[model samples]
Target: MGTLGVLGLELVQMDTPPTTAYLQIYTEERCKANCLFCAQAKDSRAGLTHIARGMYIPADLDAVVSRLKMAYEKGYLRRACIQTALYDKWWEDTVYLIKSIREKSDIPVSLSVFPLGDERYEELCRLGVNEIVIPLDACTPGLFDKIKGKSAGGPYAWERHLDGIKRAARFFESVGTHLIIGLGETDEDAVKIIDELHGYNVNTALFSYTYVPGAQLVLETNKEESIRHYRTVQMARYLILEGIVAYLDMRFTDGALCDFGAQRDVILRLIEDGTAFQTSGCPECNRPMANETFSMMYNFPRKLNDKEIASVKKELGLG
Candidate 1:
């Protein structure tokens, strides 16, 4: 089969627009895992962006960087981030490519590489990388394996990913992970995971699960469930960051987020604290159009406008 080519343009919002840059390119190879919910998983061979949520369409690496360079030189985007997929240990080329861009460009570079050990991470840091994102796609071991099927040796070790994040955070000013919703994980599960990451001083970017064709788990998820998950995660982040609530005090009933050990009004205040607007992945990394659709935003490219914040709050009955 022929290789997939670069796709279309997407307009996005940023907490502070004209400051952060985003670009997502194809991995150029299929992922080795058999993650049931993903399109790029083994045997699927579907489009690249289809495999993961919150990633933009593929683009010619050089062209995208060229445009970003111009933007940075003109003071449009001060920082740029490059995120890629990992089928295994075959991402050396990707690292090299990002390193090359970092060398020639004045903008800060961030990478969301796989859980390669400290050796590769240390190398990237030396190469002028400002941040790294290790997406611990699942919170628990069983869920990790159930969704992200084992290959080579096995799916990512939960403890190991945490250890890696903790270690990376200590050295880097900004370190992050991506957590997708609707993975059969409870709202509580998602909240607790982000809470725990915050405890370790690791930042989290939350994503609502996106379904595509040819996946084993093709069942439709309740829209309310997805919205609820996003709101809870967004709120949990605010609470934790504001020191209003602890992870242990958060409560859930039957997979729904029930309480954050705070008054209702306090939770609302936290949501509006712009804590939700804090960039999730990497320092100065704002991925506009990262999730494909503007309305179905995985991350708010810009700070939430009055309309958006009010709309989301109303949907969750928080308004």
Candidate 2:
């Protein structure tokens, strides 16, 4: 069972659930990367089921596919996403899994995997991949190395990931990338990357760094600070993506965002709309509670009501 299944979107049990109809599947193999922030790192003791803040039970692919097919037919499933962990022959396994899912259903597929070259991407496009996610987990090259690259003895490279995202933008219509906040990066660092990726026409999925026990990188948690920073970045990404604001229009002081270069009323109106605070990812993909708890939501899975909007305003220092 996948995380959604465990969260009560059970394919075999639930006839109708009010969750996003996207099915997420992760490769069972252990990842080779030793990223300090990741629970799935090669040296981490965290179990596979606890890697992504959700539990996944190992099950037969055929059975999983049967359930997915049922969900798709019943209008409970809209798309499917396959996430790969780095391992020997992982790419081969990912391709095979994509083929398997395609053979079984006509639902659009999105793949999150290690950076690959042009030929491999072309092959995936031919395989009917609807979109591709190449995650630049850390914003800057220095932070990338320290968090997910050579400083951590990880296989992923900063330049390689960027190049892959650029290539994917050319090949795939909907290219997406992931960014995790509170990874020892300043607000300037985060927004700069968001601006650069926006230039590449790639969608950015912003995530807050959720503390996991026994992780290599031990960091203090500041709820107020984290919420402020995340809300600011989320709003910035949404504004830039929607063409409502540009990176040049954003101003920072001492590496922190101080001004959006837009009128205060205009900014408030945009904030009140509340779409900026929702989960960021592929279209129609909402993994509720994937990063934080319900009361202190890092990414709202649905639109925010008036009360929720007030809560968000308080968090953003607007109320």
Candidate 3:
């Protein structure tokens, strides 16, 4: 039996149900990369069952695929996302699994894995994969090195990941990247990276840094701080991605974002629309409570109403 996300299990059991379903498979082998925030890290106490703040229960691959196919046929499963841990032969194994799923179901697949070169990209394209996500989890190179690079004794290099993102953008129409907030980076750092990735026509998936129970990183930020920082970054990301603002025009005060380079009215109008606060991930995927509690959500899986919009504005200091 392979591990499945909470949503995946819900789909299989037909619980409250989600519009989209994630197969949410992970590589069981121990990861070579020792990312400090990751539960799969070599030194982390978390095992294969714990990932991304959710518990993954064991289930058979074929049975999971069957359930996914059934859900798709019923119009409940819109996409399948496969997350991979860095391990020896992981690439080959992931490729095989992708092919297996494609053969059984027609659900569009999104793969979140380590940066692979052009040959592998072409192979995935040939296999009918929808998109590729290479997570440059840290916003700045300094932070990256400290948590996921040489300083952390990890295998990932900042330069190499950037190159891979560029390459993937050239190959896939819907290429994407992942960034984790609260990793010792400021709002400016996060927005700058988002603006840079926008240049390549690449989209980004934002995740808040949630401390896993057995992971090394301590969960220290309070609710108000986490909400404020995340809301600011999300607004900045949306503005940059939509081409409504540029990083050069943005003003920062001591590494904190102070101005979005747009007029006050324009910014307020955008904030009121509330699309900026929704979850950011693969196309058609809205992962509710993926990184925060339901009461204090970092990203809303659904559209925000008036009250919710007001709360988001308050958190962003716009109210």
Candidate 4:
């Protein structure tokens, strides 16, 4: 629905509009896979239009595609990101949407989906999808099994997801994945997976596990703990990706990151820049409030003010 407003398809107001046009395929059928955290999961009782606080209402495809062309040309949006749900004809709808956008404009396109075959990956590349994201969602295999794999009655397997990312990397220049924090993952666990995915040339985007009323999964957690874990992984990920430190160089105690191994001045410099805190994903994609509330923001959609930066430092125990 936010994308609708940005495209002028819906009357809405947003303090920080999304830079990428987030389009989800419309279908009454729920996903075949039963991922517990997903509102669109087969067994989930949550509304189908809900995806972590973002309401994606059904809209006319041609209308959205046409407006998307105008929005891109005017620079209100940078990329067209197509999110998919696992249902019959998903591939067909996804292909049609991508082709529709490509025929109208030269805008950069991104596709976020589950694992696919080599032919499909190549097809996505041909369709002008510059970036492909296959979300792992969990920090480790055990957590994955519990949340979205066989244990949760979902079709996804951790090894296959990792394998899918590797396969997709061959077809697309930019391959990325997602990891949801506060799903009972330790700081060290999050950073370690980021390091591993880095070896595969994959960029890992971070999300805080959000609780929706009708979704099956539930956990008791505090805000302070959640932010602390996110901040640590974010900083550690930056240091590792920047080549300032490696996961092996970092110190961990009881599965928590005890030290980042980078010097105080280097860490301070990164914090001041604030790129480490923004939404980490496809280029030019800043998901404003995608996984946050007004009082707490996991990913600052834009540059950080001095006060927010100070809050970040405090979250990392540096303030």
Best by TM-score: 4
Report lDDT per candidate: 0.66, 0.79, 0.81, 0.91
- For candidate 4, the 10 contiguous residues with the lowest summed lDDT are 237-246
Instruction: Report the lDDT tens digits of candidate 3 across residue range 240-269.
Output: 888898899899999888888999888889
- When 2 and 4 are scored with lDDT, the better candidate is 4
Per-residue lDDT, model 4, residue 132, is 96
Q: What is the model-wide C-alpha lDDT for candidate 3? A: 0.81
Candidate 4: list runs displaced more than 4 Å. none
Q: What TM-score does structure 1 among the candidates reach? A: 0.81
- TM per prediction: 0.81, 0.92, 0.93, 0.99
What are the per-model C-alpha RMSD values against the true structure? 4.5, 2.6, 2.5, 0.8
- Tens-digit lDDT track of model 4 for 1-319: 7789999989988989999999989799999998888889999999999988778899998999999999999999999889999999999989999999999999999899999999999998988999999999999999999999999999999999999999998999999998988899888889999999999889999888998879999888898988998999999988877778989999999998888998888888899999999998888888887888889999998999999999999999888
On lDDT, the leading prediction is 4
Report the Cα lDDT for residue 314, model 4: 95
Give the true-structure RMSD of model 1: 4.5
lDDT of 2: 0.79
Q: On lDDT, who's better, 1 or 4? A: 4
Q: What is the Å distance of residue 45 in model 1 from its true position?
A: 3.7
Task: Give the Å shift of residue 248 in candidate 1.
Answer: 2.3
